[model samples]
Target: MPLLEAHGLIKSFGGLRATDTVDLAVEPGTVHALIGPNGAGKSTLVNLLSGRILPDAGRIVLQGQDISKAPAYRRVQMGIAYTFQITSVFPNMTIEANVELAAMARHKARDAMAQAVDHALETVGLSDRRQQLAGDLAYGHQRLLEIALGIVQKPSLLILDEPTQGLGDAEVQWFVDLLKSLRSETTLLLIEHNMDVVMAVADTITVLQFGRVLASGDPESIQSNAAVQSAYLGG
Candidate 1:
């Protein structure tokens, strides 16, 4: 079974439908990219999957358990972690402290939390800045720290929303490298606009349009899909 599945998800706002019976599956140990034009309901789907917004209809299955009605925190506890498009970190806290707190929430023992924190910091290349206040870090480092905080909990599924939104070319490349290094550790559900990064790193791609799946395939197939190109890629 896939690691995550959304079956017939539907959500509407008054006369408009934000998610129109969307069905998606994310396999374990693969980087799955969800891409579409703006207002295609990508964010709505992410919110539904992350449990920030309860679905009006349909079920969400994570590792065989239904989590459609679960709260956001419960979803996290169930091994789903999300990083928003905007940076989210305790700016006043030290980098290590921020990571340590995330670890503590998931781990009981102090030693275990410390180990997880160190591992996360090192994984995101923030070990050297562990003692620096988060607000003091550069913009790229702040983004990395947000990711570090999410991974410190060792979630089975990590959902990243526009992770490279504001990054420059070099920083985006660095972030892509960082994501590549994480492929083996967990399954990723990425909502990204950068086609270069998506084509480079995605194991599989699913295109959404009008809040529904337009197509799904490997990078090559997605790139060649004439409908997809016309809808979102501006063919």
Candidate 2:
């Protein structure tokens, strides 16, 4: 079964329909990317999935359970972790403490929290900087911390909004490798503007145009799709 499914999701802002009759399916343990031009409703669709905003109509199913009306916290409990486009780390907190907070939420026991925090930091290559304050880290490292916060939740589906928005070329490449490494552990649903990152890591790519699905398929097909090329890829 697919890990998550959105059936005819519809959301509107004032007179503008941000998402219109959208349907999406994400299989387990794959990197699924949502790509589109600005004002294409990618963020709006993500908000609907993350429960930040409720859909005007339609249903969101996660792991065979309907989560369309479920509150954000309830979705978290059901194993959905969301990372924002902007960094959300606690500035004053140590790197370990930052991730520990997320771990504590999911893991009530002391030992489990320890293991989770340790593993998360290790996975993100922040084990060596566990004592550093979050605010002191560079922008790229801060982005990595945000991802650590997500993985610490041990979510079944992780929704990342523009996870690589502001970073240098080297950092973007590194993030790509990290996503590839993470593919086996959890399903990733991300909104990405960078075509290189999308092509590098995405197992499946969905293109949206004017609040509707234009094309969805593997990377090669999406890259070659005539509609996608004209609408977003500027072919």
- Poorest stretch of ten by lDDT in candidate 2: 103-112
- Over all chains combined, what TM-score does candidate 2 have? 0.97
Error of 2 at 215 (Å): 0.9
lDDT of each: 0.91, 0.91
Candidate 2 per-residue C-alpha lDDT over 1-235 given as tens digits, one digit per residue, 9 for 90 to 100: 9999999999999999999999999999999999999999999998899898999999999989999999887887788988887678999999999999887667778887888788889988999999999999999999999999999988898898988888999999889999998898899998999999998899999999999999999999999999899998999
**Candidate 2 residue runs with Cα over 4 Å from true position:** none
Q: Which pairs, if any, clash in model 2?
A: none
* Predicted structure 2: lDDT: 0.91
TM-score of each: 0.97, 0.97
Clashes of each: 0, 0
